[model samples]
Target: MIFQHSLYHIRWAEDKQILELVWKPTTQDLVAEEFQAALHNFAGFGATYGVSSMLQDMRDFMDYLPPELLRWRDIVVSPRYRQFGLQKMAFLYPPEMAPKNMGNAPIQIRGYAEEFFDVYESATDWLLTDIRPRKAG
Candidate 1:
């Protein structure tokens, strides 16, 4: 996906039903509509009838300043969360981003995804499926 915000991990899973896209929240940015549009385009490939995403681990993206660090770009992280939710599946960062505690973050995010989506072999599995024949009048 062409997201303005950086995505932590992205891949296919669960025999292709799950197109997991995990994000580690950083107050550094906001997600835009073009992001979803890009993923929507890529998902058009092949017989993979349906594609969904899993977004998780957003904390920095939601932090408001103490009247100190606040900026215009920081207006509504909460709404940004909703925008990203337009994706098939979206997971939250679950909490804040303590720079000191980032060491174990990846494991935490991946664990959440796997716990929900199960497992998949590869992106290839996401590509090949039975194509539906369009009805001809």
Candidate 2:
């Protein structure tokens, strides 16, 4: 494990070159500041370890953030991931949270690939594979 907080814990999967973040269930609501802090910490790990693949196990995550916070993640936090060479990010959610597309549609990140999954094994498997298209120079 690299970093651990009350809300989440970050783990380094050396063999797969992936960084995993497991979110813990919270009794109270999650604020944007707290969420950003956690993500900053995750980015710190990525910068330190040169992580390319990321897996977020959000099965225990139950809090909801506002649209602004979500937009903040896309505009601010995501570039940090790309800056540090992050290639693929897989979000592992519970079956109940599965999108209507059934994880078929990918989130649009200019330099990176993001996918949603309901299974841990599938998330990790996709992370380890290089099936996504490469960015042009």
Candidate 3:
């Protein structure tokens, strides 16, 4: 199954039991509202399907996240995903955009296991691992 919004596309990997969200490229930088909308969609989809693993494709995403929104992401967004049983997240970022410290960003603050990959195959393989979801207390 697939869901589409202006900022991103969400698809369910039935065989792999993971939800994949790919950000769409835009000429303008992304705003917090757009990013939040994508998160809301993720929350809704994960809740509805009870999916615990996610693969985020950021290859085509060129927007810069503002500092304030970055804080909200770590403080508010990450926790929400944890509440919805998000256990593992694989981030596929292009090599150019994937800085050395990129994995240390707000996206990794949820306390769930996460890894960054430059290739889709690696990310998908990792997400397909048999690791069970760890519920947040």
Candidate 4:
């Protein structure tokens, strides 16, 4: 099960629990509207399979979340995603970005366990591991 969009490719792995999203690089930065649309597509894809794990390949993506979008994401978008049953997300980032981008995980992903990795294989491997229940803070 695969879906392709202008901004990303979404695949529902045969492994059942995981849904993978590989973002495409853009020549220019994405505007807030475009980013919201892409995020909507992502949520819709995950809802289709009731997936528990997500592997996000962001190596080709270079845009950062602008302040407004970041606020909207944390305040609005992320809470809705939490209702969709997604428990974990593994982000595959470029090696050069591993250091700087890792700290942003908690801010970008809410109500889930997320980690950044420099390689796709390792990210996927981590997504497949036993997920312990996270206690509410």
Best by TM-score: 2
**Candidates arranged by TM-score, highest first:** 2, 3, 4, 1
TM-score for every candidate vs. truth? 0.29, 0.89, 0.82, 0.81
Model 4: lowest-lDDT 10 consecutive positions: 100-109
- For candidate 4, give the lDDT: 0.74
Candidate 3 residue lDDT tens string, 40-136: 7877788788878888898988787778877887787787778888878888999877757543422344767777888898788877775543343
Can you tell me which runs of candidate 3 are displaced by over 4 Å? 101-108, 130-137
Candidate 1 per-residue lDDT over residues 1-137, each given as its tens digit:
32333434445455444454444454345344433432443333211434434433333344333442233223433234234332222333333333432322122221111111112222223123232222212
Clashing pairs in 2: none
Give the clashing residue pairs of candidate 1, or none: 55-91, 56-91, 57-92, 57-93, 58-93
Report the C-alpha displacement of residue 105, candidate 4, in angstroms.
11
Per-candidate Cα RMSD to the true structure, in Å, reads 13.5, 3.0, 4.2, 3.4
- What is the C-alpha lDDT profile of model 4 across 19-100, one tens digit per residue? 8878888715767787787777777878777877888788898688778887887687667567888778787889887756
| C-alpha lDDT of all candidate models, in order | 0.33, 0.83, 0.77, 0.74
lDDT of 2: 0.83
Per-residue lDDT value at 55 in model 3: 84
